[model samples]
Target: MLPADGSGPTLAIRAVAAADLAALLDSLPPAAATFARASGFEAAAGSHLVVPEASGGIGSVLFGLGKGSDAASPFLIGKLSTLLPAGDYRFESGVADETLAALAWALGAYRFRRYKRGGEGGDGPVARLKLGPTVDRARLESQIAAITGVRDLVNTPANDLGPAELAAAAAEMAGSAGASFRVLAGDDLAAGFPLIQAVGQGSDRAPRLIDLVWGDPDHPKVTLVGKGVCFDTGGLDIKPDTNMLLMKKDMGGAANVLGLARMIVDARLPVRLRVLIPAVENAISGRAFRPSDVFPSRKGLTVEIGNTDAEGRLVLADALALADEEAPDLIVDMATLTGAARVALGPDVPPFYTDDDGFAAELAAASAAVHDPLWRLPLWMPYAPMLESKIADTNNIGSGGFAGSIIAALFLKKFVERARTWVHLDIYAWNPSPKPGRPDGGEAQGIRALFAAIEKRYAGA
Candidate 1:
């Protein structure tokens, strides 16, 4: 489980709704009232005010809960930590939604300072919270740690987190979990993952397949395959400058899988787990794979490249094939596969694909229970012909526009044949702006809901 700092001073907290502001403030001591008025504090949503004591020392922190009628944002209270002065704080009174508030507060304490100058954010609060039975602190901490890990991996610039680096990170995580870790890089990756090798051949960093295995061999098998395109320049079909800027986050699917793995491993779930990350950098060079090129995937299917920019599915197809060969009880593949997905569903809500009705229903319920929503887009077979190839078994891209996201899912679906259940998530993984518990930059998508479903499904296994 994730660790929390539990060592600071505890300050009483009074959460107030905008309408109840005057009544609540009137109940406070005269000096505390004066301080709030002096500060011109309005009980706006997400607004907070720290009242001072008669001795000029720190007093209670009055937090705003917004208008009483509107539905509260789950993470609205996340600002309590960093926004408040560094210390340990505890809620003075109980609230209806204690779990959401506590979790939000913990999530807001995240700091990504990998490339920051020596001392920046050094003095930031190591915000600690003491919560009551409303929130399970240990479980919440583990979730926070997993989410933060995903953000850290996605936030790191491509220079420090290429193919080998991404694999090394996963290896370290698996090592700590006592899981066996293996990697096939360079020439070794060529034989088993041809499409992976083709897309990554342009970069100096060697493309690698990272494999992690854990739990009893006889347990029900669960496999996770993530597209680890560390940085995508679109190969010979290079993207424009603005498009290339956030390419570092292209490997977000891989980051997310590792995050989910952390949660499972830490909880000691009763299932055999296997994680496959085909780490690579799709760069531009003399030997870069080109449009119209055909490559044999691990499934032995010939894939014609319609667009080099669509390299994510190529790597995933090969990795998914290997996972299928194992005939796992469940296989889930995640990737930042298509902009069409973003165009259709936007950034926050990701679209998912799965043929199994039972698994799809389970995912929907789990997503709702955890507030990590995913839209079920059709795996419409009519779009199947859109991935036609004149001389090969299939095309990496569809015929044209319209349903591009679905087409990509269909293309990937061609690779897996034996898994008992399979699901694919097309995630944005990048948050555009800071909002409550979620800060700007890399964010984890759907993993919480996915974890909930997995834990429930294999509970007695």
Candidate 2:
């Protein structure tokens, strides 16, 4: 959190690395050094020590930066937003990336209080950061708002955030950005997006194809498709209680894309942006599409339902097909589609698939620069046979469990033929535990890295 104006008496926060702690203490005033020495302050990452003034009031805070080869990330400073007392504070030194540190401070201050009575949560007033002139205040605020929007949407219970509600949220965002928004539901949705309809037919709420277009038509076209499985019960193949606990975050992909779209629109990137979300709920009922049932997709490809739990890709397939029809300069789709990705890279790093090496390089560079972890996974053609179907053109899931993430990527690749470049992101949109700048609930995984790459590619075009 940041203050509107730096007019208050702010406490100075000095970041000291573990190896530099003794030197820093020696340089400090005698009383302060003695206090720190007595306190046994070792400068471990995320650890802090508070010093008192001679008048018995607050003086300055000593924050840790860890040691070499284990130095804390710039985001580690985020911990200070909640750790420090409710007062204005300013970083005195030791932050390498000021902008990112400021952004982290804002992100760390977020709390999901929608369900809390009277919106009462947290222990006390949040610590406010006095951002320096080097930090881009507007940009940092926009990033915070966008990311928190994703967390809010994903944290919402499925009972309150069905396909219809998700569409409404997208419509609201579009209206605010002066973009054209439309939702195809009922007969229109069934006719246009058969895969989307099939996935949602079991739910009473019905499905929707949410479309939003913004920016100048003459600009290079960039389309984003997100899997909006509002709630995934794994259909007839019901998931066990343990796996079902976090199903509310099934639409995290949709939430993330909307967040990324907000960033692009706010920054006014020079590109025609189109967002497609096939909002659905994969529930179990007599009408649920059965395993082994064959269905025709929007792209004219027939798919066999190999497994009901693989419904995220079913909805995304239709949306990606629709996005590819225009043969946009680029097509990027994000989905919380597979656990295999998490098994491979864990929750902190999501795997992305793209054929364009140049664009992949740019994404990798941007990812490292922004600290948004993304790893490139091959769309291995060798795994194509695993998705073979006996009756349909292909199966919704692979014949074997190996390379599941890659198989999912290959499956979506089939629907995108016209786009000059296409990228698929398999994201675990929920953080399992609280960390610096990232809380335990829903997260916007790859949007920042994707935005950086997009901005670089199209900002000057």
Candidate 3:
């Protein structure tokens, strides 16, 4: 949505609050001000008033900031990108966060039209934002591309984006960035990633461990692990039809890490980057591993399958174990692992857990700075007992339903021992409803904040 050339005649978008409406009206042309007043525009949040030019064509637009805290949101301006007609536009006033406002504009302009028939998906020209020189054009563009890629990947259906396709996507990205790409599947997967293999064996589609490595080997190591469950039919346990509807986004964790990896590689961040994704489909068949089955993880921990539906953490356990082997400076794993996380923090804000307070603080600041909502949840070692299994070292799920998100994080923590710092992001990855910059579909949640934190820690190293 960012246009490189700002030479054309562009409409100015002025921000106005309820208290500032009178001042804005006084500044506008007489006819435009009269029309605005006649329209009864109160400058409410997400509300907009278009002013007409002397020639009756569109002139400047006044966007509502509402009152109080809503006025400070950086993404509030994102609404204009979709609301306005096709043309170039620029902000006439300052926003809370100019960089994020620009980012939001581009994000808001995104439309997933892959499966839409001609003329059905709003294929018309889109409104473009003329970014100011103060913004980092390259960084903003890279973030947009990366986040858009996440949305696209998560939006794809299971049949089209199975483990094989997911691995191919990672390989393509790695090749483009000059990173080393490897896949462990078939016999190799069974031999190495037992947990990843156990979870995907139910589906006809094979399971794979996708590995991508880049940057200087001597630099500080940062490992990212994402759960790539292409589809979760809940295995033999099965899910209700309503629950199964959005299974296509089960791989959202993988999509996010790939997005974050793209930003890091594109920016040429000075750290050794390793991305490990366990791509699988938790389908049902005779080959599916049943409940109470025990699987040896890559980390050598025996995990009892308490429920087949809790498959995300199983695959992630193997990948996280592999990631921890090198004892990277930081190990961050993102997964749509539990409904408890959604219940606790909702879909917009994901909950993250980390034992390292310094890293947590940095992440918290980054989250606030970028407007990527992330709430830090305690690891809660006292709840670790809930994962105790009679037959195995641990159970895939907690003993009861209490603190499910924390329990899942604790289970993952069992696999990660050597990392200097480890963070787990329990993300929903889907927007149930449209808001400002975020649309009603797959979303890139914690990566923006994670990228900011990682860049701050290792940019010059």
What is the Cα-based TM-score of model 2? 0.98
Residue 96 alpha-carbon offset, candidate 2, angstroms? 0.7
lDDT of 2 by residue, 248-321 (tens): 99899999999999999999999999999999999998899999999999999999999999999999999999
- Answer with 1 or 2, whichever has the higher TM-score: 2
User: In candidate 2, which residue pairs clash?
Assistant: none
Residues 311-344, model 3: lDDT tens digits: 9999998898889889899999999899999999
What lDDT is obtained when candidate 1 is compared to the true structure? Answer: 0.87
| Model 3 ranges off by over 4 Å | 119-122
TM-score of 1: 0.93
Task: Estimate the TM-score of every prediction.
Answer: 0.93, 0.98, 0.97
Candidates' C-alpha lDDT:
0.87, 0.91, 0.91
Worst 10 residues of 1 by lDDT: 1-10
| lDDT head-to-head 1 vs 2, winner | 2
